[model samples]
Target chain A: MATVEELKLRIRELENELIKSKQKQSDAEHHLRPKIDKMSAEVVDSNPYSRLMALKRMGIVQDYELLLFDYDKVELANMNRLFFQPHQAGLSKVEAAEHTLRNINPDVAFETHNYNITTMDNFTHFMNRISHGGLEEGKPVDLVLSCVDNFEARMAINTACNELGQIWMESGVSENAVSGHIQLIIPGETACFACAPPLVVAANIDEKTLKRDGVCAASLPTTMGVVAGLLVQNVLKYLLGFGTVSYYLGYNAMQDFFPSMAMKANPQCDDRHCRRQQDEYKKKEVERPKQEVVQEEEEVVHEDNEWGIELVSEVSEAELQDASGPVPDLPEGITVAYTIPEKDGASGETVEETDQSLEELMAQMRKM
Target chain B: MATVEELKLRIRELENELIKSKQKQSDAEHHLRPKIDKMSAEVVDSNPYSRLMALKRMGIVQDYELLLFDYDKVELANMNRLFFQPHQAGLSKVEAAEHTLRNINPDVAFETHNYNITTMDNFTHFMNRISHGGLEEGKPVDLVLSCVDNFEARMAINTACNELGQIWMESGVSENAVSGHIQLIIPGETACFACAPPLVVAANIDEKTLKRDGVCAASLPTTMGVVAGLLVQNVLKYLLGFGTVSYYLGYNAMQDFFPSMAMKANPQCDDRHCRRQQDEYKKKEVERPKQEVVQEEEEVVHEDNEWGIELVSEVSEAELQDASGPVPDLPEGITVAYTIPEKDGASGETVEETDQSLEELMAQMRKM
Candidate 1:
């Protein structure tokens, strides 16, 4: 019934209204969550860092800072894992991660590297950053975390960390997506990635040959989330100097089995840098002071016993000795009920003994 | 300098350009990620569900559907954990979660409940939904997961599930933000939440009394993420019937210890519904068909050996017998080296023995 001119005007007005509404929505979102310049432990709904800062209050960690590095762009397929959103597709992974992490905790300064670390030029830059990138310039970073997918990238990190005598952690999820592992690598103290290559590489099999056309590795948010959680937990433990930091931790989702073991650095490691690090570590060990033993003083909770009552142990010393060998010294009121038998062989020695001569192992792998 | 009238006109034009650019940005974002109607395991960059559906291709899960329920709104403080965004602040958590999850997998249908399930009126509705909220109406859901933060909500879920004989998984993180646990609750089969209330509840202490003014419980993304990962992994295993489903799994981040154990249902559970479910389970157990044991047949890899060589184990029968007792039947070419001693007591019996009489435990707790 309306004229074409009038109808055209109405449509244009509707379009303008839609745009205005969209703008208002965006503005409202921004207004609701204003950029915070400082981290506060104040428990409030608006304080994004309150929960995180509570760790300090609870004496879990003294402090935490985050840095990100990646050369890949976010893809829709990555949605199966955590973090990135649909709208983030095509954005550089580092930039996207930084944006999300910044919104979560703006107080922490973030530096992102979007270049590949495998390149010779980038490797130099990476090394330079590791040496100088800290709260205080010229001081090396407290730790490095390697979450790269490929063995090549892992080897590059191993080389850099070994050369710098830096401590780092390596993490990975298996191609099947049901298993993952995180390992702490202290350059000279622990085995570097190169010390024992993965079977795929050690066997002299082309990694590419494992993949087929039109097929890609499966990934699940559950596996990645668990791995990331464990990695961060390990990082917190190492940095805060609390808990026994694991040398190697593995997760198998299928059986819900977590296997952990410590691996000593290989003296015959192929990497020359690793060998140099081992030498330096041996020299430093000699220079280090021996730990002083401190005697623990017992505290008297009740200086006066008005009731004149004393507590007695339920089990006799003879019975206790029968349960195990001579009991170790214990606190006044504490007594041991039982002692678990020692395992057959020391875990560390078993692992070491399992390895054949490096050349022989390599030869066997090559034949496979 | 421009005249006032000309300057005002120029300012208006610049404002128009700004709005136009914002509109364009919004349009581009929407265009880049079009809504997908079905899940596809095509291994392409544009398919959000490709990696998830690959779980099916890899035979991990037949299918996975998600449903969300929450009465709380998203707060900025939640940013410390995974999921949710800054702009999602003030939005209902279920709605926000639904939006995010929908974007990740559009093929799955989602239903969100925004009301508290503890309310009497809502509890009935909740139960009703649970009874008929399957892909096919009038059937129950495959599983229910409880990620609630409070004991009251957990009790509500437990009551509902017990009444319906529905199986569910319960997950929680400790207040200190360093430990967590997940339990699989099969009504009448495993211990229901009410069967043994938490120590605080059993001691008749008001849970609220444990909290201090101005000090909220601490939380960590790591703990929550790990708990969630374990929970969802359990869910997948239970649904897909691959790995053994853990009855109870506890995670202590400080020690990186994962303690697993199974608990039997308490005969004197407080909940009447639980008792009824127990009786029903007992009746069903008797009615269930006995398992059929199928003997495994060995496959002949080399039917024809031209060399006519006979394979013999290196260890003799006497040596093998010395290592352990009589060896169990094994396939040809398999030999036993050493056998691990079985742990002392049945794990289930040990847990049961550790628990004092419920009344005695309760009385002791109350005295504390």
Candidate 2:
């Protein structure tokens, strides 16, 4: 047996170890474990994904799912507009977004990738990887949203999406950060990013050279939040097929001015892929089938039918049997009931009828 | 002393207790601790408040501060547009906002209050509490932002602000959740919330009653974020006096339309306080001082300022003293360099001849 003093020392050591272990576990609970396992519409405080999952409950989405980027580290500024926790400060932007969204609706499958989109190889690889799932089998992505800041990244995303024939939406905020714009590109259908040179490119100025040394551009959570909301709203509209999707929308927050316009594909486009896609679109349109309207005559038409019912042809015995046997499928709540002989007259009928056949039948019955 | 078995049992108990303690510590670190002591502009992943604090570095806000609510639990649904952590679920909405904002910008002074705004007594008490600090030395609240979802709450806030002669802004989203609006209200200078009843309230339908038993009004984080951003933006503009603060702006996300309009306060307004405010505004306008334009004639006007040397006024002794003794401010890069001329010629004569006389004396000297 050990001495009592030795036992006390052992106990103290165990207590210290226990405290560290408990701290670690608590940290894990706070930062690691997801809060929810699935989307719920309980409208309770515990439901983190309530608003997003509400889309499905509200009949806006058939099955709502999210695919977001996992590359950029979320800046402290992004916290104002996005659901990023302070403990997640050092995490990648995509990871932070995923972590936040997972807690909201853990059922939402997330795919994250980190890479500089400005490079051609990286852009192409990313596009191909998403378009054709690499390691695991997955469906092609429906829409590509470019929320990049610089012009180079925008060009790369635009180029990659154009090459893959993917539908993509581009979002950007002005340097002053008070204004923002969102544009939808349908490859061969709408204006490609390359179709018309960007404003800076049009002026033949290198966008990269415009940045002055030691000066950072201003950004606001409000501007970014608004832009992100607009982008997501457009995504829902496109996927759920509800409202009209804006082709090009610009927001000037200072003046609360929103300007919208549609842009046609440029005939003198620089990109070969865009030009090729436009040609294919034109060719497909020419070969597309035209639809024709056809009219047919039926057994009976209510007099209230537009233009009044016209008799095109005589009804056959089979057609008459089909119509009368099924009660002619009269409008809702209009039923025809026959009266029994014991009844003096048809009980439910309010109309006065003059029928010679009925009078003759009654006379024969009287003679019998 | 103690038995060996007892010591073993004690050790086991310590281990279990250690685990629990560690878990709690971890939870506190993740959910409770304020991440920042002061807002810093250091652009690093670890600094969560860097971006928000950068607003000061960017010269937008003089001293960035925040005032938020401290009551009502945050639901999962709010995660769509806000920085809500799952750990913050049980915390009141105001507390969650405070916690999150505190982590983002610990330097921002926070004043919190909890109360039902719809009740007149509660509103008055809360307003008084904030206006006259109950916990700390009193400082008047600058502007009140009415972000309440219902009409009664909006009316109460408007009334309170109007009574205090406070400037306030109101924000709301539509039932469909795809549209939103923000308006600025200057108690006496602009339309109060009650000056013209909101469209929903004017219809005499209770918004709460419109919600079905098992269904909630659909909400989108995007819509909320956009609205929040616009609201904050208007607040910043009102506070910092940089951009045009929108008086009434409405956003139609479906059509990507933003409509703006202005309305004057109704002369026959229902709110007695509003009517009183309008009258005070009229009285103040009458007593306001008028501005007058005063032009000084001491400075010599340059002849080439227009028409390239058309005669304007003769050069005076005072003008000569002002020009030679003190530097005459030139438009851009034309510096005045006087010549001593080896003490043989007048030093400032070249500029003098152009003006005309010591008119002829100046002209001869200028020619020399």
TM-scores, each model vs. reference: 0.77, 0.70
Question: Mind sharing the TM-score for model 2?
Answer: 0.70
| Per-candidate interface DockQ score | 0.22, 0.13
For residues A228-285, write the lDDT of model 1, one tens digit per residue: 9999888866765555566777787765667565555778777899999989987876
Docking class of 2: incorrect
TM-score of 1: 0.77
Sorted into a CAPRI-style docking class, model 1 comes out as incorrect
Q: What is the TM-score of chain B in candidate 2?
A: 0.66
Top lDDT hit: 1
- Residue B261 of model 1 has an lDDT of 55
